[model samples]
Target: MTEEEKKTADTGQQEEAKKPETSAEGTKEQKEEKASADTKPETEKKADGKEEAAAADASAKDDKKASFFKKNDKKEKELQDKIDALNDQLRRQMAEFDNYRKRTDREKEQMFSNGEANVIEKILPVVDNFERGFDTVQDEDKDDAFVKGMQKIYSQLQKELTDLGVKPIDCVGKPFDPSFHNAVQQVEDDTKESGTVAVELQKGYMYHDKVIRHSMVAVVS
Candidate 1:
């Protein structure tokens, strides 16, 4: 062979070997790019999952807080209702006690007034006998020592009865009242008006403003 032709063939053979190495390097770069793409997607998915879990936990905590507040409010309402019921019961009991006290006081006062009236009614007969004994005395015996002593004793008794709120009812020269006077007989009298008391047959007595004994009288008609 010629030297120029051999040199040209050798240069062509070397260029063919360099073409295989270049192809291998291009294949390696394509594999590395594919692996980087797959890893990037997995990393983003993990970060998103962690963020979602955090949000769900925060929502659960908020729900628990709201439930706790609701329970507390219900318990407070129940306690307030119980307090109001107790206060109403206490007021009712106090009112009942006050009414009972007033009733007992009225009963005691009525009983005491009835007892006093009964005693005054029994003593009125003795006062009438004393006045009759004094009326039977004569004018000649009026200056006797025994009669004077009896007069003094009768005057003292009358003073004591007056001090105890006892007084004689006036029946003569006054209009006849059915409330204070009882007529035994009707009489015709020229000096007195009709339907009036002409004479007091028996004395009547009063205790304070109440008539203990009615006046026995003769009416002028």
Candidate 2:
């Protein structure tokens, strides 16, 4: 063979030996890129799971807070209702007590007035009898035993009437009052004023500071 042909054959053998080493390096680089891709997907999945758990926990806390507020509101409303009822009851009781006190006071006043009227009524007839006895007894016989006895009886009747809150109204020489004096006779008298009481014919009686009977009087002009 010629020397140039021998050189070309040796170069072809060297290129064949380097082909296996290049193929092995390319395979190792492909394996590393595949492993990196797989690890990125796993990391993303873990981050998504953590975010979902946080959201669930927040929702649970909000629900618990709402429940607590509702319970507290219900309790407050119940307490307020009870307080209002108690206040209303107390006001009603106070009004009842005031009414009772007023009624009792009125009753007491009426009882006292009634008692005075009753006592005066019983002694009125005795007073009338005394006046009749005085009219029958003469001034000349005033010193006599019968006259003295009648005077003593009249004085005792007066004392009894006074103790019972009975009083006599003076009509002689006083102005005529329709409330306390009843005109029984009319006379013309130049010495006395018109519509004035000149003389009292019958005694008037007052019971418990109130007029029970008016005096029978004679009016003059």
Per lDDT, the best of the predicted structures is: 1
Question: TM-score of each candidate?
Answer: 0.64, 0.62
User: What is each predicted model's overall lDDT from 0 to 1?
Assistant: 0.89, 0.87
Structural RMSD, model 1: 5.8
Output the number of the TM-score-best candidate: 1
Give the Cα-based TM-score of candidate 1 against the true structure: 0.64
**Candidate 1, residues 86-107: lDDT per residue as tens digits?**
9999999999999999998998
lDDT of 2 by residue, 88-153 (tens): 999999999999999999999989888878767766777888788778877798899988887887
Task: Give residue 130's lDDT in candidate 2 (0 to 100).
Answer: 78
The alpha-carbon lDDT assigned to residue 136 of candidate 1 equals: 94
Report the Cα lDDT for candidate 2: 0.87
